[model samples]
Target: MTYCLALKMNEGMVFASDSRTNAGVDQISSFKKMRTYNNGTDRVIVTLTSGNLSITQSVVNLIEQRANDPDVPNVWNAKSLFDVATLFGECLREVRKETAAYLDQTKVDMGVNFIVGGQVAGEPQRLFLIYSEGNFIEATEETPFFQIGETKYGKPVLDRFMQPETTLVNAIKCALVSLDSTVRSNISVGLPIDLVSVKPNQFEFNSQYHITEDDAYFSHISTSWREGLTTLFDGLPAPDGFESNTQAAVTESAQPLGTPVAQTSTQHSQTLTPASVNASVAPVQPSSTQTEAESSSQDNQSSAPTTSLMHAAQNNQPAQRSPAVAANQQNTK
Candidate 1:
């Protein structure tokens, strides 16, 4: 597994990727997943790859080789990001055609993905998420970022913190936080991350950072993020009906043992508008008042009344039932 993401913002764009790859628990290894192609004055491409190492390496090698061959239509001479991405897809397809058939027999997956972001001379800056099958979609104004590889764990922060109007530095900080979340939650994504930044129309990488375990800034970010989450969690109000300070009056302090006073409703709760009961509905437990003897006696009585009550509620005919009884009956069903 891997985690690679790119952000396209008002100031510029940021690209980041982790370095760890693993075949199994004992087969962990490190590999640089980010590759850059540049013509210095016209176009610059930064790609963060994930998936089968062989497939990704082959794709990169092919792209680089063809990029240097003047006869080939490469990123350097490509007029647009679309052309560059199409060329990338072609490179991916070429690698797949060469290796997938042989690898399939050995039961090795040829899957690979990429985050392609940067600029071409005349057009605006862009970011794309390239699929394993050589298809891709570009980032849009509504969602100005793309992430490839083990995407879920880090998604929450990105969704919360990123915006097209965000400064490039803040966006990169969010990206680092996003990476930190993935690294913490998943063993397959570890670091020595590669980060690259491209300013709008620069046609060259504006900056790059190689982050390793000993990096102080990353460590600080990790610490600050942890504290922030902790603070946020602590400050969040307890559920609307829940009282945090109540301790059930120590049970023994209750005048009677059936149900303590502290457990009773402080104010009448709004009648529950029961959602349609489904398979996940819990089996309702009988109250202490519904003892075996009492239940057996009541079994002889018409449950026909409760049935009518349930139908009334479901049909929106306000046949008033005591809140407690209504909740109990619904749970029973």
Candidate 2:
């Protein structure tokens, strides 16, 4: 498995991916998950892929072959980013068609995902997520980022930090932080990471870097993020009223209020205490109980000549009654 993230920002775009694949415990290996194609001044396209390394490689080979072909409409000839994406989808489909039969014979799964993003002359930068079936979707203003493979563990941070208007540097920083989170939580994704940044209207991409284990910027973010999280966790207040007698109190709190309180277990007696709030054993009949309480309080109000129902209604703690009851009382008055 792998993790790839691409972001389309106002100022530019950012793409990142991890480079790890494993067939089994004994067959773990690293391969670059990012591939970039540049036509000098006309366009620059980056493809980040995950799943089924064979299929991904075949797709990349097909794309390169098409680009090199004089007769084919390749990345260089594509009129817009949309056309480029369609070309990629076509390439993926062709690869699948060519390899599916052999891979099926070998019983190897033919799964692959590609995140293709770049700019072509005369159009804004665009990003596309091409699926195994050759269908694709582009990023939009509302949803400005796309992530492929092992995405869930790293999504929350992006959802919180990424925005269409975010600066390119900050967006790249956020992407690295996101990768840091995923790498810590999952083993399938690891360094070295491929990072690419593309600025708007610039036909070529800038700031492409390989982040290995010893990369200073990445190491600083990873270490500092972990330390910051640790400090934050340490700074959070402990559960309220749990400083002493916590286990006993929690256990007692779990029991029904009307149920007989049993002796605290010796193992937890020192830490356990009864909860201040009692639990309700029976279902609360909101209508009947509230009506009875209201009627008894009304009787008290009637007995006190000075305290009128009107005055009681004016008070902050007016008698608790349902809307139906209040309507009935008003009709009678």
158-228: candidate 2 lDDT, tens digit per residue? 89888898999999999999999999899888898999999987867779889999999999998998899
lDDT of 1 by residue, 1-333 (tens): 899999999999999999999999999999999998887888888888999999999889888888788888887778888888898899999889988779989999788898888888888888888998899999998998888789999999889888888998898899999999999999999999999999987877888999999999999999999999898887776543234433222222223223323434543433332121122223345568768879786777645444456788789775755555767999999
Candidate 2 clashing pairs, residues 3+ apart or interchain: 245-271, 246-271, 248-272, 249-273
Model 2 residue 145 CA deviation (Å) reads: 1.0
| lDDT value for model 2 | 0.83
For each predicted model, how many residue pairs clash, with residues at least 3 apart or on different chains? 0, 4
Model 1 C-alpha RMSD to native = 12.6
TM match of model 1 to true structure: 0.75
Among the numbered candidates, top TM-score falls to 1
The reply for model 2, stretches above 4 Å from the true place, is 237-239, 242-275, 278-333
